[model samples]
Target: MILYPAIDLKDGKAVRLLRGDMDKATVFNDDPAAQALEFVAAGCEWLHLVDLNGAFAGEPVNAAAVEAILSQSKTPAQLGGGIRDMATIERWLDKGLARVILGTVAVENPALVREAAAAFPGKIAVGIDARDGRVATKGWAEVTDVDAVELAKSYEDAGVAAIIYTDINRDGAMQGPNIEATAALARAVTIPVIASGGVSSLKDLKDLRDCGAALNGAISGRALYDGALDLKEALKALAG
Candidate 1:
């Protein structure tokens, strides 16, 4: 499974938020582009970026920081947040984003997800952030009655490149991923599922890898920043 080092942007700085709480954000790096370079140097194949402010604002608030990272690194990156419309999707893709993950729109306007997937093929992905198995949107500010698995299955034929499943409750808590739920979601869908949130160690990575279901990859933020998960060691372990 691919390990995606996360660079969540809040006010143009790299930060990690606890349980999706914006008020509890802890800044990691002031120079996000430099952080991207550091991750690339550590042998990360892909980077995961989230525009924390943009997600709540419904517009690309950290565009400059994202562009800086893109310009500095050759590693292909996938980005989510503030990307709601076709024009915004097209703009980010043209600006060097390898993939565009549609989150809130996936629940509110699935037709757009279908249209974008049709238009961009493998460049589109669905991000399902959940609390208690119910999908959350608008940067986790609102929770919906949508079942994560059912929503994932709904996009089975949409040609979505992957489904990024994040369990918000465990996020940044260093508790480890919800392996059972993530694995089940992966099993229930033919489309690849990338696990996100609460990934705290190499063992966690191994568990996800050996979970008996095919996971596309996993995304981690706080663990890497706090030295809970050594990126170099984790990459070596995953490589094995």
Candidate 2:
């Protein structure tokens, strides 16, 4: 398991939300690029970034902050939120993002997912944020009737790199990840699934590592920021 460290940007600052609520966000860093470097310094293999503002605005809002991170860190990073079109996808990739995660478009415009996947191959990933197993879009502000597994399965042949499955309720709650749900999603689809939200401890990382679904990784934000989970320790545990 890769143990991706998350950097959620809101108004150009690093923050973690309570159940995806924009107003409930708690800022952790004044400089997102500095936070990205901290994760890199601790030897994280990959970074998971979400533009909270962009997700809500449906366009890149934290572009400067994200670019600042890319400029400072050499570690490969994957980003999601507010990226709804081909032009935006191409722009981020060209700006040195290792992967562009398509979430809302994966539900609203699956054809775009296919087109982007075909165009970028391993550079594209689908983010499935679920609330009670139904997909939530537009920064988790809108919930849809679409089943997460079915959506992921639809892209089985799309050649997208991975599926980032996040349990919205568990996100930033520090209540631990929904291992069974994430594992089930991984088993239900051919795409690699990365678990996100509420990953709070070293044991949580181990649980995901041994979850038996061949997860690509698990994302942790609040835990690391609050010192509940040490990045180097979690990375070592996952590596072991």
Per-model CA lDDT versus the true structure: 0.96, 0.95
Residue range 1-240, candidate 2, lDDT tens digits: 898999999999999999999999999999999999999999999999999999999999999999999999999999998999999999999999999999999999999999999999899999999999999999999999999889889999899999999999999899999999999999998889999988999999999988889999999999999999999988887777
Clashing pairs in 2: none
For model 1, residues 200-234, the per-residue Cα lDDT tens digits are 99899999999999998999999999999999999
Q: Which candidate is the best by lDDT?
A: 1
After superposition of all CA atoms, the RMSD between model 1 and the true structure is 0.5
**What ranges in model 2 sit over 4 Å off?**
none
Query: What's the CA RMSD for each of the models?
Result: 0.5, 0.6
Number of clashes recorded per candidate: 0, 0
lDDT for position 180 in model 2:
92
Give per-residue lDDT, candidate 2, residue 118: 96
